[model samples]
Target chain A: MRYLLIYDITHDGTRSKVADVCLDYGLNRIQYSAFLGELSPAHQRELLLKVHQRLGKHGANIQLFPLDEKAWVGRKSIEREERQNNE
Target chain B: MRYLLIYDITHDGTRSKVADVCLDYGLNRIQYSAFLGELSPAHQRELLLKVHQRLGKHGANIQLFPLDEKAWVGRKSIEREERQNNE
Candidate 1:
């Protein structure tokens, strides 16, 4: 399933760090504060757990939105285009 | 482009009426108060105008979100599935 995770960082200087971890885990950064990702159910659970662990109690707020398939198409296209450009 | 429109009805008994109008205009109802639609630029503008006209001053609030191609994929799949199942 594809999910849109919207989060705000609680600690200082954690935006880049959190974003790096998310990218490493295959989450596509959409807006500065939001990410879009597709994961198996197992992966989704793992990712969320890892995020919580990484952020600990300082992870501001998180909203996980399970998007329908249509939402994923646009995000995937953008990711594909970005990959093709190597940027 | 695909867009998500989230709005709340201001007056009473307008939910069903508004939803009916949205369905007529090919917008997919996601949550009770949210809709996902793929619309041409022109159509989007027209739809927004029409929605405002229909709701007048009683439309609680409206937020229009433009989704990337990936996001549209999920919605379209659900829509397709719905279309396939008539019974």
Candidate 2:
């Protein structure tokens, strides 16, 4: 499954630190502030725990949305259209 | 690319009504309240416009996230894990 992790850092310094931690954990930064990654439920749980441990109370607000294949295709089509428009 | 549209209705009736319009617009309901759909930029724009026009001031809050193929694959992997665990 694919997961979109959208998070807003509380401060600029925190964003950089969070990004570093995410990179270390095998997650890729998709947008400026969002992450795109693949992980099993167990891995997801581990990832969240790591996030909390590393950032502690200073961690940013986060929302994770899990997508199935069909939804993924639909989102991809929209992205293609957006890219085409931008080009 | 994949897109996830997450929305929260103001009331129960609004939820049912929004679901109906989403069904009419070639979108499938993924969660009880969320929609999964493939749409081009033009279509996305049109969809939003229609949603606004139909629901007017009563429309629910909506957020759309566009994803790339890689992200979609990742998300799908997570969903598979979740489903497997459920089964």
Which number leads on DockQ? 2
Model 2 residue B55 CA deviation (Å) reads: 25
B18-60: candidate 1 lDDT, tens digit per residue: 5676677788976555666777887777776666556543434
Writing each residue's lDDT as its tens digit, candidate 2 over A1-82 gives 5676655565576557767766776788755555667767887777766666555445356556675565455542112111
If you superpose only chain B onto the true chain B, what TM-score does each candidate give?
A: 0.68, 0.72
By TM-score, the best candidate is 2
Report the Cα lDDT for residue A1, model 2: 59
DockQ of 2: 0.06
- What value does the lDDT take at residue A68 in candidate 2? 57
Interface RMSD (C-alpha) of each candidate? 16.0, 11.7
lDDT of 2 by residue, B2-43 (tens): 456655565566557667767777787765545666777877
lDDT of 2 at A24: 70
Cα error, residue B5 of model 2, in Å, equals 6.8
Residue A39 of candidate 2: its Cα lDDT?
69
User: Candidate 1 DockQ category?
Assistant: incorrect
